[model samples]
Target: MKKLTSIIVLSMAVAATETVNAQTVQKRYEENPFTLVYDGAITRNEKGKVNIHPITYQLNGITIAANIYTPANYEVSKKYPAVVVAHPNGGVKEQTAGLYAQKLAEAGYITIAADAAYQGASSGEPRHTDKPANRVEDIHGMADFIAQYKGVDANRLGVLGICGGGGYTLKAAQSDKRFKAVATLSMFNSGEVRRNGFQNSQLDTVQERLKQASDARSQEAAGGKIRYAGVASITDEEIARTPTDLYREGFVYYYRTYAHPNSSFLYPMSSLLDLMTWDATTNIDLINQPLLMMAGSKADTKYMTDEAFNKAKNAKNKELFLIEGATHIQTYWKPEYVSQAVNKLVSFYQNNL
Candidate 1:
């Protein structure tokens, strides 16, 4: 009888332990990981006497949600200079784009940081679709939105795009004279990166990738679940395998520390397949606006920035500023780097606008 009781007690303890472990697993796994925004930043819910509002704008028959951060002491009748902020490839407006918008707005400018179509709080069909033309149109759409706002001076408008957004911004300014001044920090020419290669040399890998994405479309149309392959969550082992450490740094910012409740490390996985065909640098000859393209000296994308700067012709005012010690993602949210970017931008706009 004593042996029987002991056995039963041991079994109960083992079951209880298993139950606790299962509960922990369920709690983490059940909470969807891709639904976060701002990572942990308070940009979306952040308050300012400048009247931050959640607004929606129509683009290509779809509505995109945007956070408009206005000037704190703005006057309704007075027209203020405005700057349109664009987000990174997979990021929403709440990430670095929102941060820059908030900072610029605090600097007494009306800043509209919008989520690209088919992603984040924005509404669109076949979500996570990436067409260079559509993305560029999204930027132009935001410009149109700001141009019609209560206190925005359309003539004094400027543009600031970070990373992939930077590339799209450049393309927008190429033809849209509406942008009096333009700037791109860590600009990524997606076409070059997608076709030629990362640093503009490798080719076979990109070709293979193109074939894979092209093949997947057929499988997708057959009532099949699309399997997206790209960087979502980056583990430490993934970081070590990279040729440069900057990519690892980028992963830390986008996937881990700044992971928003609505920002997904993997939500835009389908966008990668479309990215293979999108190019934001084809029409570089049309940027007549005062252009300021700044990049970190140590960034992996510095080479691409150089290529773009060389291509942008006929711009009367253009300058390329390289910060001494910064990486591609560093300028996104870091105070020291952000301030540097904003200062140059403010100076350029003030003189040009």
Candidate 2:
């Protein structure tokens, strides 16, 4: 009985530690004036220094909440290269996307990161609809707004998409010529994963899942209760038991270390009707712009980036960069890994844009 008591005590202590750590992270976000969650986020916009501006605009009649970052010594009268950053699936602008945007701005470029429609701070009904078309449109919408922003040189525009955003970015860049240079980090093919399952683990359930998704759409059309897919919340125990490194680390990053109220993993079940039928690599040859794709060498999701990059036959000066000994989530916030990525990004943008 003494041994059992010791084990229980240890478990409780570990849980308590996790809770305190999560609270510390949450406190950081709540303290920021802009609700910026990333490390070193701007607390105030100052002249002659990198600044962040929270702005909103209409995209397909939906209000898109975005943060635009300007480099030090920015001037409205001078032309500057710009980059539109698309967030990962289930991520908001205040997370890794915002971190990257701020870093790019520090590197002497203007950058904007926006929440996807029906997600984060953006306005859309039947929230968290993860449609491929809508996500691709969000990237295009960013380009539309940033291209016209003061001091922006539209001709030198570039794009950086992370995770699921990376997949959508490929699709958007296929037709959106406004983006002169294209890049992706830890590209996740939502369609392929939703249809085939992570690592094809659910290939046997493909037809069954498709049927369920169809039924969900039908119910929605008939004004029935909306069904949602994915985890709305997860406990520490569940997170520890999650099998894949991609998912396990992702949960820790999104839900614990960088938790944001506006960020969630849920999506309308009906969204699978579109998501399962779409792919990021379709007509990938359409991307004729300079392309730079980066992924962690140790990430399980690296396969998706590899697959997409292989199909990008027509991308001008295409390159795939791998950060040594990094995982999918590490690229988001690990100081060393992030530094490596930001350095590479600055060099790529300078050379291409």
Candidate 3:
């Protein structure tokens, strides 16, 4: 009887902990419609000033959830420059993407940030699909939707992508001529990392991982069960023990301080089939629009930005700017770094857009 009671008590404690976590997340989300967790996020929309509009649209038969921010005193009759902001991998439209969109709106540009089809509040089945082609198409879909929006000048449309979205933006810009100028912040080459592994740390396991992904795909096709890769949750101790500042801070941003119920690191294991064979730097000469790529000077992922920038041979005008004394995730929410990035972006867009 003693052993049985101990097991019951332990299970009850675990369940209670989970319930509290869930409630906490719910309270945070309810605090703002934007659900923004970053410091200095606008909590309310003011009329005749920067305003946010929650919207939904269809993309390849899937419903996409998005937030569009219009500049102060926006008028449908007057044409204005516009930008499309793409969210990061395993990210929803509400986090850093929304933060940038709000900032750009304040700078007088109409900006829209949307949740990818299989993530966030967007519609999808067997959730958390993180395929590259779908992500690239999501950017295109945003351009299509936002171009027709009131007061937007389709001819002056620009694109700004963050993190993994940065990689997809590069690919989309290669074919989508609508984007007159393109910029990326803290660019993470999803394909390069997925294929070769982070900082080339998993080269030897490439074949083995590919086989695992293939098997997972087969199992999914056979309706056996779905498999997922990546972190769903982490303890504070695990985060403290993380070796790299990028991941260490990333865990805090995504899992705790800025935590959102919808945001997760999980992706279908089968996604590796496409991710392992792709490269963001491929067909490097196709980008003819002006490009501005920014990263933290101390970011571990700065190498990815450097590699992509060097290969953008055909960009009309290209520059790489570094935020001083900042790390990868730091660029996401740190006020000082975020201000630096936004100012550079404002100037870049003003000159080119």
Candidate 4:
């Protein structure tokens, strides 16, 4: 009876702790008007310090919402290197992409992080459409806009994509010679995962999934109700029960700690029709520019990066940097890991850009 009582008390304590943590996170989210959830986020733009400019531009007839970060004491008369940052699938510019853009600005570079077409604050129909071609085009659109910004040195442009954005960046850099340097963090191949499942766990269900995606597309064509896939919301217990560190931590990060109203995991089910047939590594050797790919040393998604990195045979000055002692999601916000990544990125861009 004593042992049973102790166990029950422990369970209650754990539950109470989780409740407190969730409430704290909720309060933080509500307090930030910009919906910026990262640590040390800029509250207001000031001169002689890093400043953020929220701007929108028309991209292929869709309005693209982006945040451009200008360095401390920025002068439009003096040209500065610029980077176009691509966010992960289901991510908005206000999340990790914005954090990196802000950090890069502090390092004296002009950086722009934009919402993909049909996602975030950007304009599009059947929202959260996750297609490879559309994602790749979004990166191109960012480069097109930032290259024309007043203080940007268009010739010294670079691109950095995170997670699924990394996969699309690989695709974008293949044909867009405007990006002088290309880098990726925690690279995730959306095509491979959508078809094969994470870590290829659903190999046997490929055909079945493809058929379902095809049907979804057919329904859309017929003007039927649009369907969405992926997690809309999750419980703490569900998050704790998730087996993979990438997913379990991802749930807590996206739905709890770093939750934002505009950020979501849902994507149009019809999007799988385009995503399933695509691959980020196809013709990767076409990327002849300088390349840097970083991933957590212990990330389950590291294999995707490894496969893509190795296939970029023609890339100049190629490197694969592993952030020590980090899982895939940890690199997004953990201070130690984020610091390491930012430093490496600054060095890489300085040398190549």
Best by TM-score: 2
Error of 1 at 105 (Å): 0.8
lDDT rank, highest first? Answer: 2, 4, 3, 1
TM-score of model 2 (CA atoms): 0.96
Error of 1 at 176 (Å): 1.5
In candidate 3, stretches whose alpha carbon ends up further than 4 angstroms from where it belongs are: 1-26
Tell me the tens digit of each residue's lDDT in model 4 across 79-188. 99999999988888888998999999999999999999999999999899889999999999999999999899999999999999999999999999999999999999
How far out, in Å, is residue 148 in model 2?
Answer: 0.6
Q: Note each model's CA RMSD in angstroms.
A: 7.3, 1.5, 3.6, 2.5
Choose 3 or 4, whichever is better by lDDT: 4
Predicted candidate 2 versus true structure: per-residue lDDT over 32-87, tens digit per residue: 99998989999998889999999999998999999999999999999999999999
lDDT of 3 at 248: 91
Report every candidate's CA lDDT: 0.76, 0.94, 0.91, 0.92
TM-score, candidate number 1 = 0.83
Pairs in clash, predicted candidate 3: none
Q: State in Å the error of residue 54, model 3.
A: 0.6
For candidate 1, the per-residue lDDT at 30 reads 39
Query: Candidate 4 clashing pairs?
Result: none
